[model samples]
Target: MFARDSRLRQWLGQWLPKRPVTRRDSPATARGGQGDVDRVRRQYLESEQRFRALLESLPKVAVQGYDRDRRVIYWNEASTRLYGYSSDEAQGELLEDLIIPDAMRDGVIAAHRAWIHESVEIPAGELELRHQSGELVPVFSHHVMLNEHTDEPLMFCVDVDLSDQKRAHRDLEFATRFDRLTHLPNRQTFEADLDEVLDGCRRRGLGLALLYLDIDRFVEINDALGYEEGDRLLIELSRRLSEQLRATDLMSRVSGDEFVLAFPGVHREDDVMRVLHKVQEVFRRPFGLEGHKRSITASLGICLFPDNGAGARELIRNADVAKNQAKLEGRGGLRFFHQHLHDDLVRQHRLAESLERALDNNELFLHYQPQVSAASGRIENLEALLRWEPLPGQPVSPQEFIPVAERSGLIHRLGDWVMEETCRQRAQWRDAGVKLERIDINFSGRQMGRHDVFERLEAHLRRYRLGPREIGIELTENVLIEADARILEGLHSLHHRGFRIAIDDFGTGYSSLSYLKQFPVTSLKIDRSFVRDAPGQPEDRAIMEAAVFIGHRLGLEVVAEGVENAEQLALVRDIHCDLVQGFYFYRPMPADAIERLLVGGVQSLGSLSN
Candidate 1:
């Protein structure tokens, strides 16, 4: 190859000889072959100079070449521009010395050795390049094997500064997948991670567990301590949970006060129990926020891979079902997925569907229980109660159906039906010359929490052409425990519109006297549990007395329910209870029967007498 290149140069030098003469001298007359050689050499020198200037003028990009032994052969101007090193400085330096970080030197060397032996092109991958100014810049490098004869390798590295790109990517990822307040993974990320883990478990024959956790009474804490303190407490709790879990565990915030943890490779039930026990211990410690020492508890439900479910949706559903069962069993508990829970869920689903059909089928009916004035012994009002009559041979109690209705979002329909029916009945009675004072219907906590309840009530009143004063809404202490401001506003609006509000089943839950005073309550109904044993059990008597006094102190009338005997009635009368209702007065009867009793003065009930 050298001899060929030399002979070509000699022939070029002879053809283009360097001279001061121009076209004036003919080719044959010019200084023989020597003139041609000189002319060719001059032309070659000009072309070489032009090519060198063009390469230098372009942008700084490196083209490097190395042998199979990893010896540097060429370094372009771009290398100098990027690494603050000239060609002279990089000529003898090993390629590894220029691009690889000190910690990754051994790995780079091994990778290069493998590439040389395999004679394969290793495309650009991540590497750190040390600049002359001592700053390490993250870069991508490409290595290529160029020669096959002597096992020589040619490598070209194109370094791109990725610090800004990395920062922007991380920020975007955080915004998309993490909660801002607690720095925990959010629902979107949690679902994605759960799917990924479940897929892997299926492929690898591994065991996976998912724990769904919900903080008990978190709303109460938020309401009692203000939102700022609540936020602080949540942040602290998230931090504590992160600290307590293993590094391999994945924890995420799926909703308000609800979290989900994915435990990978938990082969045994004991492993799951141990992790849950540790979590319980962590939450058992009291949290001190702004001088208030408050403690919180979690109700957790667990579902395992290939046992409870195989996919993300099924696993989450089973876990949620178990969590609900834990809550139903009481707070601060844990439950595992079982066949019975699945069956119960299926039954609930069917019941919800049937309830939706019930409304359309006109199977819901109302029964009226007369409330008699204690002083006059005359029926002053009638409480409207709902009854669902399923298909033939199926009789379901309100206790069993009401909760399902509330959970399945069917309460709104149920409430609207009751309201319209109550108003229509009252209007019918007035038109028929039967004097009924008011019709009180119960409202579920879910119904009371709805924003559109006032509009619904107004619409129903207009539909029936009934006055708002003739309709009353009864709510239990559970409604107040929710303590939603929207609910309070709704109650106030109803009150302003001349609708009376009654607190049903009072003294059965955590009734705060101070908060109760602020409510626009017109009456309080003592719980039947307390009334059932009243005038006999001392505790029941004391509770009944305190309730009557509290109601009177608040300037609200008190009604005693479930008064089955004369002794109970006399005791309530002595306490100055304003109204009494129970089997002692009358069982709930159909609307026609109630009207007959109203017209006949209670003598028409001989057939239903106990």
Candidate 2:
């Protein structure tokens, strides 16, 4: 049996084991087999060594592995090169201790547990690692759990330095939130900070304050000087405001000449008063810019938290409403939010909405006021004035609707309609042999700023088949104050097209004489305010005389408006005014009514001198 078993073993060895195998011989054979095992072991060691060398030689990325407890077990040489640490120094280190900030350690551990238990893939995301030099290096790390036996887990991580990416993202965020001109937080940042502060206040049962501030007469300064000087002044103002604010306060530039302040922990009304007083005092000091010393004042409005509003948006709205009230009452003052202010804002909003639909609903019409020659006392031109005849049970004054139209961006369309209607009426009068010399249409400040003003005017002239010489555009001083290059270009184009330009309500704005020489103006209409008291007021007379003299010197035809009496007319004629139009001559009448008098001539109408 032993011999047979030995033979069987030997046969088995020959077939499967590849060696002679007797029970004792098998033991001897096993001893010889150790040499072959050592050779195979040596080969595996050499191959593994070559693989480790190749992995360390590659410059692709840094790699590290950690056990379930977050203890580093393996760290490649690339980890040393990328993180300023040797593999020996990093190995056996707790990953949380090496890479995670103390504040973020709990979150990192939670994420690792989730990755292990859920077998979830944690994608590449930014993390901060402490290097051998103790400096934090931002890195994009991709991590995954390796459950080799589907039991104990190991975390493998590949890290890429994201310092450049982090810096770029920070810079982009700053640029988006900060204004380059004033270097203050912009409107977007202001709104974000406001929301955060309001949320914090609500959560913590704290008080907050909001201040809406607008620079008074900023537009006038911008118009009189230039944008560069204006920007410099705003920067200086921002610096001063920054100095005045507390560390917890945030100041932001919300718009051109408007700023918003958010003050958290402002629990008392006196604190708001104190800040406003400081702002006023700081602004009262004169600012020197480009060889000019100028002083500016701000209108400020305050809205308190929990009292005026419950949230950021409502607080800002209430503050804005109060600010407008401050402007309406008088600029360079401060006001607090009141319920009545909200009512007023609601009314204004409704009115603005109604005005938006006014033109579409055919509620707008034109009233023709005769423009009689001062010398001949004959109606030669008609000035078309805008009138808002609202729907039944509603009546909107031009004073109300005109400003609304300007604010709502509807003035351009409304002005075009007025121009078309005026030209059509003029053409009708001409066809009836009324012999109208010109039809003057009023242009808003917005219309003058339109880039397509010239094109639109030309189209209207062609549409009515009227000559450019037969129409005149009357612009207020506000138009020139807008002072856009496009406006000047549009006016020049109109002049080149043979359309006459008249400065309406002249002498009411800054440097009228300077603009008269600068612009290609054909006529000057003295403002009615000056004319209303001209006969009695010596100042008014002197202003009128100076205006008339300036007009003649500049070779501009002077027209006096608001001549209510013969006495005023005598004053106008004495100043050698070229034309006159007012209630005394004739009130604004319908197109057909004006046509009848025009066809009949001066003899058919009553005396205009009155």
Candidate 3:
């Protein structure tokens, strides 16, 4: 069954079977034949309606037909929906005017003409076509030529809307390379762009300041509030930090609570400081954290290109080292990567590499320093110290190698070795009948963060046949201030088990009094800086007075550290300090040397006694 159009009817007639019923010999035969012809006609009409329905119903696929002139001869409902044109409005319109963008019109027309006349197939491809409202629409369009080889060939186009696919692809790419929370370039993109930016700088002989910034004590903030609040804080911080950079600068979110920035064309220290100060100002202003205003600060690490590092990884690593240095020197400050600093890092790396096998090689050992009573000059207990000797006459100071071990994640191993050796030494002293009240082991803040720290400590003591009372842990004031719930809880469990906890190097750190009081502390060690001048200066005397008063008030033993002279000892004695530690009493010595001192009952340094 042909459509209502005469041309379609003529075309269908050539393809359909006809049952002709003319005057026949029998009327019955003729009637039967006419019924067959009627049935055939009805079937043809149904097929035609089905074909038309299929073409019109496609929601995202538009089908349009054109004559040799490239004018729209047929436009289905999908075409109307896709191009924002009614079928009536699209019919008789030129295909170029209907959907071809101005820039692509000529190429589209040429491709159509070649397909129509030269029998060349139009390549099916994606295109940005113009919508009726002047917006661009993405489409995957293909062609179908009907009645080809005839004088009046008709070409039908099948166009699929590709907007959804393209949009999805774009979103996936963005998610891969950006921080979803802050919508900033993430580590992957940052490293990639850094390489490109470094190349440009190399070509132009330009210098840049690459700064790595870390939000100090961010873990405490995250734990005190929640992760959602943490994300909000990071988003706001990114916004504020972004406002501090020039258009030429690049910034990226490298990790949680950490950002890396690059300032191009900044070669001089003055220029570097300018950008550094701008970043610092961002933190000086208080932030609204969880609906409460809180002052936040960051440690900034700077690395100058071509001076500090030669590549992206090098720069990032060096910048991180400088940032860590700032954090170590008390945060909210900046440190530059000097050549000497890089050399020191190289040495640390070497040391760490060496330390990986130091335990097996027996290159590590422990020394004991005695802490004595300030008033009677009687030894109370010994402080265990760690020492390293990589080679003969090549002793590496704990000050240098301890940090190297911590950063290399070898601190845990070193700490285990220290504990085992210290316990072994104490057991030896006990067997020899040399009495020691208890010995204290210095615990790193990093080591205290272990989730299984309590179990590990208990296991160590059990292995040594020592109770918690025979061993104690010394922590720094910074450690107490920065301890999260887990660490503080771990400390409380240790303290509850009768392990004495002392805050080492007190009054020399940015320890919050609020947080300090919450720690399970039994003693406070006055920092050497205050005691070094306490015997002579009024300010130092005042600081020592306040420290001792606060410590005793809290039921903690106040010990004056770095008491190297008689005057300092007498002053601490007057201040009622419970213990004294420094070279004035006994220098850190090998276990054998210290054992002799203990077995001989030589507790006090009589030469230094007042």
Q: Tens digits of per-residue lDDT for model 1 on 80-135? A: 77677788887778866875568777866776766657543444656567777878
What's the ranking of the predictions by TM-score, best on top? 3, 2, 1
Consecutive 10-residue window with the lowest summed lDDT within model 3: 1-10
lDDT accuracy of residue 555 in candidate 2: 89
Better of 1 and 2 by TM-score: 2
Q: Quantify all predictions' global Cα lDDT against the true fold.
A: 0.78, 0.79, 0.83
lDDT tens readout by residue for model 2, 182-235:
878888788888888788888899998889999998887888788888898899
Q: Whose lDDT is higher: candidate 1's or candidate 2's?
A: 2
TM-score for each of the candidates? 0.66, 0.69, 0.75
State which candidate, 2 or 3, has the greater TM-score: 3
Question: Residue 440 lDDT in model 1?
Answer: 95
Clashing residue pairs, candidate 2?
none
Residue lDDT tens for model 3, 1-610? 0012345335434433333444445777675777777886787777667767777777998888888888998888988888899989988999988998888788878877777677777666788888899999888876766666888878777788888999999999999999988999998898888889899999999998999999998998889998887888899999998888888788999999999999888979889878888898898889998789999989989999999888888998899988988998876968987777777878888878888878788988988888888777777888999988886558888888888778888888887777888887787778778889888999897777767766776777788798777888898987788788888788888888888999898888884676557779999899999999877799999989988998898899988888888888788989899999988888899888888787773554643444
**Superior by TM-score: candidate 1 or candidate 3:** 3
- Provide backbone clash counts, one per model: 16, 0, 1
- Candidate achieving the largest TM-score: 3
